[model samples]
Target: MENENLLKQISFIKEIDKIKYIQRRTKLFNSDRNENDAEHSWHLAMMAIVLAEHANEPVDVLKVLKMVLIHDIVEIDAGDTFIYDTAKDHSNTDEELIAAKRIFGMLPKEQAEEFIAIWEEFEEGKTNEAKFARSMDRFEPLLQNTSNKGGTWAELNVDYQRVYDKKKVINEGSTSIWNYSENLLNECVDKGILKK
Candidate 1:
């Protein structure tokens, strides 16, 4: 059973490599290349570690890292969802849950349960860790948009109010980050990169 579990774990690790192929709408900092789920996850983990000091409430850095790492693994199956695609119906919740089970289930039962619990906690976004993790999710793309001279927002014609609505979750995690994001948004508007 132990060897079988090891094999299962190996298979799961290999399976998640598909995440690298799942390209996001966000661009890399100072680059035109689109970012992938793997890079996004890694960036979020780093952000959790570096920005934990800015969180409004105390957070478990490891827990935040874990949440960001696995949060998008489901996208390997459900595909990447663009944040500003308001016309796209918000209907992927069920699909993502199914994907989460199939992907995380590749591990031993106990390990799968733990991963699923963390993923679910992220989806719920209520705990301090989850809130902070979600903040990173929103904040990273904002940085990407700012860095790339208005990235997806400019390309998609997303307006300032919509951007604010989408990113207000940052306030729940870190007041400092939210303030910084607000200033960035204003700069984007002034630069005429983001729609006003």
Candidate 2:
């Protein structure tokens, strides 16, 4: 039974490597190269460790770290959906749930269930850990865009209101980060990078 579990865990580890190939719209900071899901997840994990103190409420940093690391594994199957893309229904989680099951399900039953729960918590964005995990998700891209002179916002011609609406979730996790993000948005506008 132990060997069976180990094989399943190894299978899951191998499967998750696909996430490295899933490209996102946002580019790396100060670089034109697009970030893949694995890179984004790794960056978010580091951010959660570094910025946990900024969370609105006390959070289990390890839980937050796990959430960030596994949050995007579903993208391996569902593909990367650009947050600013209006045509796509961002509220729909059915596809993501399916992907989550298939990807996380590669592990043993208990481990798979735990990962699914963590991923769902992140999606719900209600708990402090989930909120902080989500904040890292939104915040990383914001910094990337700022570094690239409004990277995705400028390329996609996304307006201020749309960007603000999408980014406001950051406030739910960390008020200070949200304030800084707001200032960054306004600065982008003032600098003629993001459209008002």
Candidate 3:
């Protein structure tokens, strides 16, 4: 049974490597290249570690890290959806849930359940860890867009209000981070990088 579990774990590890190929709409900081799911997850994990102190409520940092890292693994199957995508509903939960089961299901049954639960928690965004994980998710793109002089905002012609509304999720986790992000958004509008 232990050997079978080890094999299942290794298979799951190999399967998740496909996340590196799932390209996101967001560009890298000060670069034209698009970011991939794996990079985004890693960045969010780092953000969880670096910004845990700023969370509005105390969060289990490790759980936050897990949430960030596993949050997008479903993208390996459902594909990356742009947060500001108007044509398609942003909450592609049904498709993502299917993908989540298939991808995380590669693990041992117990491990798969844990991952699915964590993923659901992140999706629900009701707990402190989920809120903070979600904040990091929204915050990273804001920094990237700002660094690239309004990376996707300019390229995609995303409106300032839309960006503001979407990024407001940051406030749920960290008031300080949200305050800074709001200021940055205002600056982008003033600079004509984001349309007012």
**TM-score for every candidate vs. truth?**
0.96, 0.97, 0.97
* Residues 44-137 of candidate 3: C-alpha lDDT, one tens digit per residue: 9998999899999999999999999999898888888788777777654699999999999999999999999999999999999999999999
Ranking, lDDT, top scorer first: 2, 1, 3
**Residue-level lDDT tens digits of model 1 in 1-196:** 9999999999999999999999998899989999999999999999999999999999988889899998999998899878777666443488898998999999999999999999999888899999999999999999988999888887888899999999999999999999999999998989989887
The true-versus-predicted C-alpha distance at residue 147 of model 2, in Å, is: 0.7
Q: Tell me the tens digit of each residue's lDDT in model 2 across 55-171.
A: 999999999999999888888888888897777866336999999888899898999999999999988988999888998999999999999998999999998999999999999
Model 3 poorest 10 in a row by lDDT? 84-93
* Pairwise TM-score winner, candidates 1 and 2: 2
Over 4 Å off, model 1: 89-92
Predicted structure 3: lDDT:
0.91
Tell me how many residue pairs clash in candidate 3.
Answer: 0
